[model samples]
Target chain A: MYFTSFEQFINMNGHGFYVWLSYACFALLVVTNIWVAQQRHRRLRKQIKSRLGRSAKV
Target chain B: MSWFDNWHLPKWFYQMASPKWFYDFGARLQPWFAGLALILISWGLVWGLLYAPADYQQGNSFRIIYVHVPAAILGQSLFLFMAVAGAIGLIWKIKVAFMVARSATLVGASFTALALITGAVWGKPTWGTYWVWDARLTSTLILLFLYTGVMALNQAIPDRSVAGRATAILAIIGSINIPIIKYSVDWWNTLHQPSTFTLTSKPSMPPEMYIPLLLMVIGCYCFCAWLIMQRTRNEILDQERQSSWVARYLED
Candidate 1:
């Protein structure tokens, strides 16, 4: 609403590149951290489950 | 006699020391924390980027503060937290404390890096340069190094206990840099401006600008809490794999 039009919003008075770049990097970092944590959690659970299966087989 | 010998921690504190208890508690609370973070951060970012009026002087570039300031604050706070957790582990020999300290290191480092990059991007437009050798910047750079050093030390040591102790000592020693980072702008003739928010005085910026910033900061902290808890739970599962409770947990 600050800007009159969507183009102006994206332009951000010609400082758009810098503003959006910083935000993009921040968003990427947040997503990557969450994804990595989730993956690690899944992998650890899988490892434990496989170990449980192997011991049970013996 | 040691000063803490007569001191008794709360019952909940003792319960939190148990990895299985913490794992279940974290799992229960994790969704709330994550949801809160997502809502707050998204709201703050939208309000800050699209709705808030631009800075009178620096214009749109100042918007970077929304992300930069929160990242920097958390980066430093998390390091200090890591150090305190390390201290707890050292003093009480609590295994869970060590795990917390370990989990904080990676997250802290990522935040520090985020702060640095965003600061540089903001600087290019405001300060006319992408990088500076100013006291505040240099000290924050040192903070990033301290975090990485603790991480490397943790990976190098084979035994978990030994690694934890080693990293804890390093983290405590590195904590000295936190104060240096905090006071750097005041202590030296740095190009970096003084802090926007101080405890004793009101925030320098107007509510429209600062309110969103506050939201972002709180959201970042919540996100960090959620992330750290998730990682700590994984660590508990890994470290306590041989325990019967862990086996039962997996079964469920």
Candidate 2:
């Protein structure tokens, strides 16, 4: 096994800081991308709706 | 008869060019891909974090590979995928392809950013430096910029068709860098390690260590696929609102 105990595994021989930091950054990035993708979708939806609304009124 | 066929990409591309067809296809594919992605990720993370032996030299720090390598590979490949979609849309004038390209570029750029940042973090400890101008590193830097350039070009053109063509040109030209990025470490001696994923010869790490890396790579890819579908559906809806069917579909 890679580690003797759960605690040591979590500790990662004190390299946990780096390991976890890397993970944290990766998670943040993925989350942010998802958020941005959603935002883009919403923005495009609004734009399309507004365009349609204008055309409909005319 | 078998469900799948030999000419997979063409058939897939044809189906993808129709928004309604793409939407149905995405719906079918998304859940399966997402489930497989989640399963593989869970399996890989558990094995990598707890089962695989720490690197002899790097120790536990090497665990970052489960994330970094896949992010990097997908980061690069997704751009190529977007460019191809853009080209198809531009040449064939398929609105769905352009929409897919637009949605995908954003996701690809995001992944590329993640890869570069994660790499920098890993580099700090292993290389005793956070960033450097090594050939491999430099090429990847260029890749990030290329992704940015394509994105900006797509947005700058006022007309959507012109936007697609402009970005397609940039994407095609930028593709030259993918090969350069792939070969940078090999072509030049550098601080960055040589290829982690390979086809032949003995793997640098043991099976336990590499397996999770493999799973994470697969998961990253699946996640990309899922994200693209999710985002492209939104794009299609946005672009196709003028179609009478959109109202009926959205009503549900």
Candidate 3:
């Protein structure tokens, strides 16, 4: 409903490239954020699990 | 216990200081927000990009609104959130607040970058150049540098606690510039056009176009919030790994 079609919408008359590229940049940033979070989560999870085991033994 | 009735502000924030609380909270809320983010972003983009009619003058180039405006708004708003979070952590010495500040700093940087890049692209055909040193554009560049400064401050200090205070101070002080960046387009006769979506002023465009724009902006904001929660939770876990609750978390 935002537009009629992807191509039609992107075509922004003749400004499709700019609009689409701007979106490309947007997508890039979002994906990067998600990736960084996931990576940190993995690292932290491992760290917490390891520390918990050592503390338990101690 | 329901997450609602039991929630008290002080205890709630204090509990959030625990990595276990953050992890559980993030895990619990992730699906809801993820779904919301997906739905809003999809519906909004579809409406803005497909349903909305192209502008008569700019033709299709005006479609950049779907991305440009939302990113610009989120970019500025995210920095404000960072400054607030940083200030709270600095004043209260709350570890969770600091983590949230750190997450927001990174997110703000990314959003600011997206805004400038998108704005430049949108400028080329309309303004007859890829970039112009318009007042708004120049101020936005400064905004991006401010984001970098916060990020750099976070990394520079070796001590985590000290770094938190330092970054928080910088973020809060730098926040003063946010309003300036926002008004630059308005106050100065800048090359950048004024905002399409305004509160008091009636929109010049048709409902079809404005509707999509509204959707995109809302969806993007939700997406940013969800991402911040996830990142902040990660930071909390990293910091509180020595705690018993973290041990309990690992057991799960």
Candidate 4:
């Protein structure tokens, strides 16, 4: 709304590259952190489940 | 007798010390924290990037403050949180406290790195350089190193108890850098500007700019809480895999 057009908004008056790049990095950081945590949790759950299965078999 | 033993602590404090209780409580709260973080951060970033007025001097480049300040603030605060949690773990020998401390290291390190990178990028446009060895910058860099050092130390030690104690001591020692980081711009001449917010004074920026920043800061805290809870739950599972409660937890 501040910018009259979408293009102007994206351009950010010639500082667009810097602004967008910083945000990209931030997005990457957030996504990577969440993804890694979720993956670790999933892996641990699987490992525990399999271990439990083996013990029950014995 | 221990100092806390004489005092009557609240019920939630004792309940929080139990890993199982923490895991269940975290499970109940994690989704809410994550949802709130998502909503607030997106709203803040949008408002900051599009709606907030540009700085008179820095122009649109100043928008980086939204990310930079929040990341930097969270980075420092999380370290302090880690140190305090580590201290609690050391003083009380609480397993959950140690686990929470351990979970905080990676998140703290990531946010510190985020702050440094955003600061550098913002610097390129405003200060005409990507990096500087100024007091504030250097201290923040040290904070990042301190976090990594704790992580590496924990990984190097084989036994969990030993690793916990070792990292706890290291975190407490490294906490000295936090205040130094806080006062770096004041204590020494630095290219970095002074803090935008202080307890005794109002924020330097206008509400339009700072409001988004406030949202971002609170959102980041929520995100950190969600992430830390998720990781701590994982830690509890890993540590208590052999316990009967964990087995029952896995079943249900």
Which candidate model has the greater DockQ, 1 or 2?
1
Candidate 3 structure, TM-score to reference: 0.84
Best by DockQ: 1
Docking class of 4: high
lDDT of 4 at B135: 57
Off by over 4 Å in 4: B181-203
Each prediction's TM-score versus the true structure: 0.93, 0.84, 0.84, 0.92
RMSD of each: 3.2, 5.5, 5.5, 3.2
TM-score of 2: 0.84
lDDT of each: 0.87, 0.77, 0.76, 0.87
lDDT tens per residue, model 3, B125-205: 767787866555556688899989988878889888888889888878888866766576456643444443221133487
Across B1-252, the per-residue lDDT of candidate 1 in tens digits comes to: 277667799888889889999999999999999999999999999999888888877888778889988988999999999999999988877899999999999999999999889888877776678886555566678889888899999999999989999999999988975676558644664344454322112247888889999999999999999999999998999899999998888886
Task: Quote the lDDT for B241 in model 2.
Answer: 76
lDDT of 3 at A14: 64
Candidate 2 structure quality by residue, lDDT tens digits, B156-237: 8888767877887788778856786557645664335454322112347678878889999998888888888889888777
Clashing pairs in 1: none
